[model samples]
Target: MSKPKAVVIYSGGMDSFTLLNRVINENYDVYALTFNYGQKHVKEVEVASTVCQTLGVAHKILDISPINQLMQSSSLVGNIEVPEGHYEDDNMKSTVVPNRNMILLSLAIGYAVDIEASKVYYGAHAGDHAIYPDCRPEFVNAMNDVAKIANYEPISIETPYLNSSKGEILKDGLTMNLSYEHTWTCYNGRAKACGKCGACVERLEAFSENQVTDPIEYE
Candidate 1:
């Protein structure tokens, strides 16, 4: 019998990349699904492709640029200036695209059903719940139910970060021998990570908390 196919919503960030290895290590056939949802950081998508390629997993980068126009109010889209400082600040909420995760996961679930994949994975950590409502455990559970009913199948949405912190995820990934240096976590659309951006600050903190220095270059 073939192994169960799992589609991961990978963004080449710490959490998603960790989730990718977690699923792969579990012996599931992994497929990485990346979305270009008009975020200021296009580097994440490029990094996602690299990560998937390195893992020898099937990968696809879906164009969801239209959603960017619809979500123009978000700081992540359009010409809005990327916010600097910590991820826990109220200013970071400005970057949240309304129902962005729902939209992405919905699309991934649809694709999973089309491909007969058994599980869909998303990286939603506890720290993100303060800024993103859709990243909450309740939201993920609700979406799982909705997707299962919408597809009329037993498909499931997995949130490995539901009970984990960003620091824990970095530690887990490091323990698994996962490569963190190539993963991009900047909110700015730049060649090198702007160390002041909210995402960059968060990533730095995670590595710091884990007592490990992040290998990625930052400016």
Candidate 2:
């Protein structure tokens, strides 16, 4: 029998990129699903496409403008300022989109059902909990229950990094042989990481904690 297939909700961010690598390491037939949710970083969509292509996996990009319209708290969606500094700091709250994980998981579940996949991988991690409540293990478990009930064939949601810090995620990615250089996690929507944005701060901290050098360019 062929290995069961899995779909990864990739966004070309560090965590999602690492999650994609983890799914691939499991040796399941992997497919990548990206969303164009009117984010400031449309470049992430392109990066996600390229990452999927490089991994030789099937990829899909969904138009989720309605979802984008529903989110305004996040600087990523509207004319809001991208906060600077560490994600764990108070300034990072500006980036928290309301119900982002709920929306993403709901859409991913629909796509997983359509694609006949039983497992969906997401990159919600401990590092996100300071700003994103939906990234927590409780929310993930709740969403998994929803997916199980919603899908005719039943499905499982995997968040391998749920309890792991960003540093741990980066280390796991290395073990999975991921090419981190191509992934982008900047909230500034620039060609290089702004280095001052919360996402950039987190990425840098993760690498530093791991005692590893991050290969991505930053300005």
What clash count does candidate 2 reach? 0
Per-residue lDDT of model 1, residues 1-219, tens digit only = 999898999988878989999999999988899999878788899989987887799999998887787887788886778788787898888888878898898889888988899899999998787888999988998988887788677789999779788998888898998778878888887878899977888888898998888988877
Q: Each candidate: how many clashes?
A: 0, 0
lDDT of each: 0.87, 0.86
Score candidate 2 by TM-score against the native.
0.95
Best by TM-score: 1
TM-score of each: 0.97, 0.95
lDDT of 2 by residue, 1-219 (tens): 898899899998889998887788788899898988888877888899988888798999998867777788789887898988888888788888788778888888888888889999999999888888899888998889988998577889999889999999998887776668888888878888899988888899999988888898889
Off by over 4 Å in 1: none
